[model samples]
Target: MNALFPALRTRTDLPALRFGAETLTYEDLGRAAGALVTPILGAGRVAVWATPTAATAVGVVAALLAGVPAIPINPRTGERELAHILGDSMPGAVLAGADDVLPAGLADVPRIDVETAVDHHSPVSAASAFSGAEPDDPESPALIVYTSGTTGPPKGVVLSHRAIAASLDALEEAWAWTEDDVLVHALPLFHVHGLILGILGPLRRGGSVRHLGAFSVEGVARELGAGGGTMLFGVPTMYHRIADALGDDPALVRALGGARLLVSGSAALPVHDHERITAATGRTVIERYGMTETLMNTGVPVGSRPRPGSVGLPLRDVELRLVEEDGTELRAYDGESVGEIQVKGPNLFTAYLNRPDATAAAFDGDWFRTGDMAVREPDGYVRIVGRKATDLIKSGGYKIGAGEIENALLEHPAVLEAAVTGAPDPDLGERIVAWVVPADAEKPPTAGELADHVAGLLAPHKRPRTVHFLRALPRNDMGKLLKKALPEALHG
Candidate 1:
């Protein structure tokens, strides 16, 4: 069960990854990992702050080999959030970017220069006998993924190695990935998608991966069209961007000529955009469903007709159920009965880090009640209708999560506060209406500008159809935005 890297390292040497101009074979990458492990030679944790580059990947694997949990820090995360995570996790050491400063309270902790570590020879000290001890007990914390909370605070979900591995195994089995496959790695490594599916999934199957610093539609299209990779994973936004970038370009279409699968997750893929992408790239978007707590649960099978607005069937090891408001179980009918999605499997997380109450309240017995609301078709395929609470917006057969949209909107400089909610629309099932509190209320960013901002950041379907300015959002005594009052603007 242990010695994952050591077991994989035994395989034949082959080109494992291609990033920028650097090509790292499995043997070379494994040796680099061995070298990096020498810096933090103990069982604790280490934070990685970089994109999904070959060196970063090697450092992460090295930390794991040394029995050190790798905490991937989001490069875009504010300093305050970084400091909070570092203080909370209290890792033994940090492998950070050359220019990125250490968190305030973490100045006392050991910080190994990653470039120096990479330059050193692969240490043979711990390679003889790596720690077989489980860094992440079934109940103990392995990885801490921060999710935005109602109070703007972040909650870290602590998952175990078994849990994450189970999810990756399920994904590998479901997607039918093999060593012959080449995955285009564009998602941020800090997120579950990049860390698990982009890196671990491919590595586990001995498949090759091509890492990108960030998702660039043109870059991806050029790579795919040039026969650079076979498989591509991205959110709906990235796919739409690709579609836009490849508009009427016969060259781009020919570039993705040999790709077998194009995956879309993180958020729902708009039905229109899905069709547009298929028409543009000659590839059907294989949509899937999962969150931070659970790595992967369902995916549209390869070579199968992707059901419109449906995330497709659950994985072999996964179990899914729908329940009414009274906790009444609902079966798959014609895919119209909306209910809360409950899942139970080896892939599910152990618990929320240091939040027993949240963990206990999140489940219905052994099943983890995913806060998402969905309906299952007669064939057992699931279509996410909306979120159970907090963040839910359904538009034109697409169920978009608000958290993802808000995260995108905040990326703009002029945006100070942004909230997305479903506004009733006669044409498109539901139109996304964004209420934003601008940085300067008097000279707020124009609706057209804000729309363009989101358009650049998000997919066509996810962009707010209407932008409404607000002095301040409606908040309760706790200062949490009351989403319940959000619908009034549209209905009135």
Candidate 2:
């Protein structure tokens, strides 16, 4: 019932956002965002060209202030994917920066330049502007974020104010987040991790965020070392770069060593990189697990030393369980039995927008099936193996998780990057296959050697039967590996 960002009203003069050299205090943000609220109030649903800039944040904030559902479209989205999102959401208008060149798909929709709106209404106070607005409702849809849609057209996950607030609050408890903490990151703005948590999380806590226009180790070092950023959030790829750079850059080691928290999400932080960073900086990067359908399910709590492979315990109020194939809940947390993760919590999206069938299928009673597979430890830690649909490989009567094999392959000195999948074999129902980007292309490790490396680390059955070497593994914008996009030739 209360405003999502309470600090916007009370903490008027404190620095709220920073993108490169530009900075906006809480007062500046409120006025700029508040000016756009009137125009966005009655809009059925607004689409934001979610670029990583002040305008994008302002536009989304304005939509939320007016209680209108805001759909964030990724700037780098391909034409076909952009078309699908525009057609699916049917937004009444598109909000973008003053100079942004929009695609033809958005040509039919009305355009709103967020900068011009702010300039035209500089006199408006956020409090005075929102005074006449409709009362806040916790259950109202706040954001409609689209999934990666690896299988089909991306589905819009309808997130409510309740879900967003609960997620942030739960994270506040877990991470010891507060207004004094300054967060820094280079994640894109369209997804929940970057937009909701990276941006909105700070605003909700009345904290500050310093966003690097693009990710660079130098930028990370500068921000944390001198810019007063207490926390850093990034995907594994960015951290991998940091891990690689730490050995050569003392400033980076010092920057990361001094930070209060370093969080990694959007993909698994390979244990190799994790150990590398920790060994260099004496800081363990906290990893959390979630999907667009659920804002957040689990995270490593502050002051707790995390296990190398675990994502930590479920956050406050989130009910999590590992379930068998037949939907039977697994009670043993021995850390070996793998099962699909099913969650019941307030930090969950209401439904898949415009797809009742998908909305219905996503839920098993009150629990939302996360499609992610994991093993639970006796101490309540959750170590995710992979996605049930793509990462779960049934090979030779054993249910093998591609993630564990990928991690094992990464442990080998010759492997720079690795993705594991199953391919059909005449003898075995499916055989474990490893797609590798070798550390040395000219003298790559042989298939037998790599397989033997994995067998030495894990069981023999978990070793790769086939190994394909590549220059690079396919990855999405957030550094998540596109396992489905791997070469068809390798499978054949």
Candidate 3:
């Protein structure tokens, strides 16, 4: 019912967005976004070329202002995946930068160059031109974000304006976010972590954001060390690189130490990297948990002591519970029992676009089945073990989480990267297997030594029965491990 970005209404000289060397003041952004409302309005849905550019932000904001659902397409998407998304969403037109050369998939679609649409000469009041025209229905579809399609074809997750508003407000409470803060990140613009939280979150708080365009240690140091940024958001891979460079680059440590908050999401942050970063910089990298379907479910509250390997507590107004395989709820939170996480909250997707069956199957009454397995401590801290399908391993009459094994493997001095999964086993029902990237190529750690290392840290039963060496583990654009893409020869 209310405006999503209140800052766009009033004209101000304050910097609203900085992408690389280009900076857009609040007034400049409001005028550019406002000028394109007429072209974007009445379009059923628009596809945005979500590149890390200021034009992409202007296009998405223009679509939102016109009350049309915007579908963001990743620029680096493969031809097949790009075709699938375009065919599924079927947008009326594509909004992209003027200089962008679209692929064959988007060639037939009408294109609106956002850069040329700006009317800098005319003073178009955003308050009167956009938000003041009419109040939007809270249930109206605002965004149609697609899933990763690891299991099947990517399904479009339809998120409502109410859900987005609820998510940002809850995060404001959890992080103590305000207008004075300047956020910084280099995350991609396709997923919720970067698009919803990184971009729109700052807009909602009337704050500023400085995007690195591409992630680099020097960029981070330059921005934060110069006192231009107060907060930082990154994925585990980015933080791992930061930890690796902290010792060599004192400037990097100083910049990170000066930041008010450093947040990591999209994948689990290993405790080894966490300790390494903290030892160098006094700031702790806070971890939060969420999915494409759910904007944000839990985060560590601001001003609280950071807990390694834990995703703090359930966010404000979010009801989270663990459930057994039989669908019964588990109430005991002694921190050892692992179960699938089910959640009920305002910050949830309306449905999978054009898939009624999937929409129905995803929810049990008001709660959504997340398919993530986690253990909850008595104090309400949530430590995600793994996915229900890939991360949970049934071995020797015990349920073992692959994430725990992976975390323990990362602690070894010889292991550079690790991913844990299960293979069919006759004796143990399912044997835990560790796929490792060794720090040393010529003299890698022996399988027996790595297994013993894990057994000493965790229980003996949780130790990997097989260890496969690799130069590098498979990862997606967001640095999330792709367990399904692991070598099949090792399993055979």
Candidate 4:
């Protein structure tokens, strides 16, 4: 019965969640979630208004308690994407906070307003006896998380209870996690990094989480300095802000230095941020790699030495392998040979919901093609180069990774953020073009200077042939640079 949330009932007296001014004890959450059983049970699928609110957490937890497949819709999704998700997932009901105003597209779906209260009490059920009804099969779909539609329309990834359980358990083991650990993050509730890992990871271990509602450097310092949080999780943007503010704030330096582990994911944290954080706080920021299809494939274990930009070893029970472009498996772990990563494990989603062809294409035999390009160290640690389609740039006589050159540009004091892409050129098959956000717009570094910086770190051929300056790089809610949407957003 406790397969999905192993510690839901057992962690009764412990403080379970805090978002802004609202707080919920484990006991309080149990009753609130229990009350939702009647409404959610028997419903095959539901939708959640994924806002950074306490009610959003309650609604998701309630759906999990009732064994219903919950599809979390990003609150900021565009009209077209929102329409696509609504039509594709076709959830029976949509759960929203009491204050959320329904969009015109969601007018047809039955709406359930989740109460934001957390102090209501009820008799604590036995750990084995909680809930409305348990799914007879653990393989029943628990969540239908939609993918980021970079190539085409977004597809719903069906995650079963068994997959969710395997993922959280493996993370617990990898991080040496326990109930004593207090997690802190201000990420959104729509994606895996925020919803599954940020929310469910702590609950599975009977631990506590303090959600900041929204990320801010001040919020981070306030919580870590006096909030008693032992571990912190964030995307690269959040870390970038922290790194930028560290030189001016002593409290931030102390708070970050005192934490047990600092994790960065969703997108790679620039190597410069890693160095800045380490230099200021003596804390090595850890990075992990995963996607919507696979909750978590690899991470830096709590006690391990963090290789600055590497995502570290594959998690417990996850098997990761690198394959060449032609699909042959690469057996050598030389730390420099790059290949596409394919994973096989219990932590993968069952299939892309309702798309048989898409589901079939995602897997080869038993391994799921991750579409990410990376190299493996001799010690089995993995280092991601970039994605196969967009981030792999073949220029001149060399195949280069855009992520490496972007990191090099970020290392320059004049650059704030950088994204590298390939543009067709007559000389070099596809030349490297960099989109840069300068630290100081009025005194921005010249294109030649930034190109020289990349050439200095990497090679002469790997440097960007042209540079375009922007006020800010277009990014999704999860801090992933929307490379596909860049031209439309930047040029037009």
Q: What lDDT score goes with residue 278 in model 4?
A: 93
Give RMSD to native, each candidate: 8.1, 1.7, 1.6, 1.8
lDDT of each: 0.71, 0.90, 0.89, 0.86
| Deviation in Å, model 3, residue 298 alpha carbon | 0.2
**Separate clash counts for every candidate:** 1, 0, 0, 0
Off by over 4 Å in 3: 116-120, 131-135, 488-492
**Ordering by lDDT:** 2, 3, 4, 1
Query: Candidate 4: TM-score?
Result: 0.96
Give lDDT for model 2: 0.90
Worst 10 residues of 4 by lDDT: 120-129
In model 2, which residue pairs have backbone atoms overlapping below 3 Å? none
Give the clashing residue pairs of candidate 4, or none: none
C-alpha TM-score for every candidate: 0.77, 0.97, 0.97, 0.96
lDDT at 394, model 1: 68
- Candidate 3 per-residue lDDT, tens place, 266-345, comes to 89999999999989998888999999898999999888886889888889889999999999998878888999999989
Index of the highest-lDDT prediction: 2
How would you encode candidate 1's per-residue C-alpha lDDT over 15-84 as one tens digit per residue? 6777778777666666566556657766377777655566567667666666667777776677687777
